[model samples]
Target: MDEQHERADGPFRARGGPPWRRGGPPPWAPGPSWWDHRADGGRLPWRSTVLVTVIVLAGSTMAAHGRAGDRVGLDVFAYLLLVLASVQLLWRQRYPVVIVYGTALCATVYLAAGYPYGPVFLPVALGCFAAIVAGHRYAAWGAVALLWAAHTVVGHWLYGYLPPPGDGPAAWAQEAVVAAWVLAVVAVSELVRVKREQWAQARVERERAARRRADEERLRIARELHDVLAHSISVINVQAGVGLALLDSDPEQARTALTTIKAAGREALGEVRQVLDTLRAPGEAPRAPAPGLDRLPELVEQAAGAGLTVGIGTGGKRVTPAPGADLAAFRIVQEALTNVVRHSESRRAHVQLDYRQGGLTVTVDDDGPASHAEAGGSGNGLAGMRERAAALGGTIEAGPRPDGGFRVVAELPLAPPAPLSEDSR
Candidate 1:
């Protein structure tokens, strides 16, 4: 079970997904003026603000004309209060906490002056809405509460002393209506705020998934090109040396060496071109099927061209692995034999594949006297093989064997591994 789990350093190590965004600071918290304020990006909602201002100014005038007897008619002071409340909304997004209180206070004064009720409370509703959506719940609730308290005092107790003289106390039924309106406005604002936060989180998740997919694509391409070029180039290097050494004494043998070099070069160019075409237009279908365990004979023939003989064997009932695992097994074997031809004086290598119900095992071995001078190639081949196995819920082992020479064993499960959880990361 442990062997079937992914390694801590696999390519998909960070695939659990991006961390969530931290909640913004409270509105009343002191900071730079712009901190944790705006809702719809940084730009002000100037067009909507201006439109609301226009509608409120006209709507308030119409509403004032319709008030009950003894209610004061619209005066210059009442219109000025309405204008101040409407215009203050321009900065609602940038300073929601300030806007809410500013608009609420304007409405309280307008009512206390005995101005006729109209759409006068619209600006207060908008300011409270903006504040709540900007993550200033306490500020929003307080603004509305203060407005309610002031309105109750003026209508019930202070009516004897203030504005449009000879008016009696407000009815109990009217207070209940005002209370219901308050609750509705607050409840609606809270619902909208929640939806906006959910949408923002979803956008962040999409961006993280795109970046993760791109990283995986780059890694897969790097491994495929490494395996393709390394084996082909190693074969060409050996054949070229043979061709040059025998040009005078054995023309027939030298011709065969040159022919092998051509074949290896053609194969490398073809594979490299396939990789480039895939990059150029990712949506295009592949020109050829990916090589798999069935292609081990090609590796054997290529090794022969490099003057090394490779033996192949299989054990247990043969069962076909998935496309990805089959490709990984093929690359591991090719890389191991490439090492044998390039860095070992031994002229022979052996590859074995063992099939089972749960997984497939690949092993490559050689009898060797190490060629120390050429043993210092970049270690990407082994790392790539390890990545491939681990990517498929498998494990890899590669090192010098006890008696002599190097060996590599890969265990690739039939199923892919699940991504690491956030806690695991």
Candidate 2:
């Protein structure tokens, strides 16, 4: 495992980076909000501030010139309109609707008061953009319609003038142009929404995959622990039984039994630590050599040392199998031997391994008491061995044999089928 993925006892930590900074800005921080972080005191760039200041100054100059010539009073209302509209740019993302509608109203008033189109119309158009970025598509369209209607109604009712019949087409055409501009804004914002949704879903899938992998790793660790601990414990159980029975008659042999117990404990601890170290960092731990068919003789010898008459025989060339198949073979034999010690009343058992061309076959038969059949028929051990064999696409059969003994026979494929890697499990 990588250091970033180390499994410590603590709060859960998210395993990936933020969604932003991947080419385009994330949807939540798009448009004006992207620049929101760049501003000092949350103010616009100096260039925009200077431009707005220059526009206000130019508007005041025009109003002052007109007032001096006695053509109009200095339009204090117009100056206020320009200030209100320009200030709205600052709050475009925070209060998009309020700023847009406010700027639109100010622009309408300024235009109705006979101010030039340059400064007044600029903010009005920019407000439409702010509304789109805020995802108010319908509201923006309504605002566009209202602007056109207000321009026509104010011109006719207050000024006593209307667009001529042929001029009506030109007026409607201008409304269409504004509609197209709003439509373009809507299209871009929707694309950003879709991109953000996909990014969010991808994050969810990645986390789900990580959790599944962690769970599988934990299960694998449990299986390894069961295999290593159960086998060694079974041997220790038989050895301790013999040592206790012969403590007075065979003192030296009993001391040897104690030594074997110590050795088994040390071996079990080392196996456990090796498993933990590998899980902690797969590359740091050395791989332990896997047990296979060749180890069956040693396994039988250990059982015999515990005073159970045991026999192991190989029927073929004893070829090495693939790793998965080898592990399955070892587990099958281990579980069978464990059952013979735990469940059988008889002291004599046979362990056989046949390495044929199609696959390897394992058989464990014990001639325990005739009534031992009823005692060991719980089937849990057998069921687990069967499941293990089935997982490797193999077959297992276990029950009472005809000659008053329990027999377990399993045939495992030499090469396991390809595992289902695509599935998260």
* Model 1 alpha-carbon miss at residue 412, Å: 1.8
> TM-score for each prediction?
0.83, 0.64
Model-by-model lDDT, in order?
0.83, 0.65
lDDT of 1 by residue, 314-392 (tens): 9989888888898899999988998898888899999999988879999999988777765434667888888899889
Residue pairs of candidate 2 with colliding backbone atoms: none
140-224 in candidate 2: lDDT tens per residue? 5566567666765654454333212222222456556655754665566566656765776776566656776675566556666
Query: After superposing candidate 1, which stretches have Cα over 4 Å from the reference?
Result: 1-47, 171-173, 244-254, 415-425
In angstroms, give how far residue 342 of model 2 lies from its true place. 1.3
